[model samples]
Target: MSDEVKVSDAEALRFHAEGRPGKLAIAPTKPLDTARDLSLAYSPGVAAPCLEIFRDPNLVFDYTSRGNLVAIVSNGTAVLGLGNLGALGAKPVMEGK
Candidate 1:
């Protein structure tokens, strides 16, 4: 196998710095065009699902993004090439990934 990197370190840095800093962002799946939409997305309408999830924890997957999203958590203790760099050092590396 080849251990070649397609992008240079400087190029990668520029790509991230030129944009909105990080690669991830949050966006609403539904439209919030009116007070009713706001209430449903935030207050009274939200309570129904909250109550359901409270009764059955597994329901969180069905009602929320938890089912579709996977959180990548690490302390950088085993970073590639650089081992045991700790959480603070691992943050930038993890975010870049």
Candidate 2:
């Protein structure tokens, strides 16, 4: 068998459109299955961690995914091929899809 197969431009576009643009998927770090899990992730159960973070400030990393996250901040200027989108137009391609 060959190590690689080829795809047409149209097929690639279809895959990109159907899946995430950057192929980046964001799933929950914690489970949300039962009613208890739901409450803990959102409401009363979450309050405790919020309080702890408010008290310590640094606990946000431990309780949330912030520690392992990277925000893609851009001015929308200098997008490849379509240059100088100026924030508004640049948002759609910000993920480098």
Candidate 3:
């Protein structure tokens, strides 16, 4: 068995360009349909957690998206099978275009 994978440029382009136009999306983890949900997500309700986090930084995981976030550090010098696209040139690739 060969350990190589192949994808046509047109296929890759079509896959990324379809639907939302990106490989990632952000959405509210909690219910935000009601006014109460909105309030709890911001302003008066958010202030309480903010104060708590200020007092103890460890609470960040419980109060925010820090725990679910992942960092992908890349300068865009090299892209998958595309050689060097440079930073600006690679922006589209990074953005899933």
Candidate 4:
């Protein structure tokens, strides 16, 4: 039973090496197999919303991830404990958060 926590650079490197590629991915939610699907997903039908969005910037949130994504950028020159570990060491917390 101890409150202290300690980790080394080797351990961090090992953890990163053991994982699936960086953590996130994009996947299409709907089927795009037929000509209709292609039209709807990519060209003529898609342009309907694109035009709407072109007219109103607020539609960017509706048509894309602009509303939900929050980016946190930092350098480890001023990170928690383990002082000045640089950007690489600070990545896990940034991704997790």
Estimate the Cα RMSD of every predicted model relative to the unseen true structure: 2.5, 5.2, 2.8, 3.9
**Candidate 3 backbone collisions, by pair:** none
Which whole-number lDDT from 0 to 100 does residue 63 have in model 3?
93
Give the number of the best model, judged by TM-score: 3
Off by over 4 Å in 2: 1-15, 18-22, 86-93
Clash totals, every prediction: 0, 0, 0, 0
- Candidate 4 lDDT at 73 equals 94
User: How does residue 94 of candidate 2 score in lDDT?
Assistant: 61
Candidate 3 global lDDT:
0.83
Highest lDDT against the true fold, candidate: 1
Give lDDT tens digits, candidate 3, residues 1-97: 9988999989988987899976788988999998999899996689999999999999999999999877665677678878887787677766653
Q: Please write out the lDDT profile of model 4 over residues 3-40, one tens digit for every residue.
A: 97888989866876676745455677568889999898
* Candidate that beats the other on lDDT, 1 or 2, i.e. the better one: 1
Candidate 2 minimal-lDDT segment of 10 residues: 88-97
What would the per-residue lDDT of candidate 1 be over residues 1-97, giving only the tens digit for each residue? 8998699889988987786876777888788999999999889899999999999999999889896676789978998889999997677677767
Ranking 2 against 3 by lDDT, winner: 3
Which regions of candidate 3 are displaced past 4 Å? 80-84, 92-97
**Which scores greater on lDDT, model 3 or model 4?**
3
Error of 4 at 96 (Å): 1.2
Candidate 4 regions exceeding 4 Å error are: 1-23, 30-46
87: Cα error in model 4, Å: 1.7
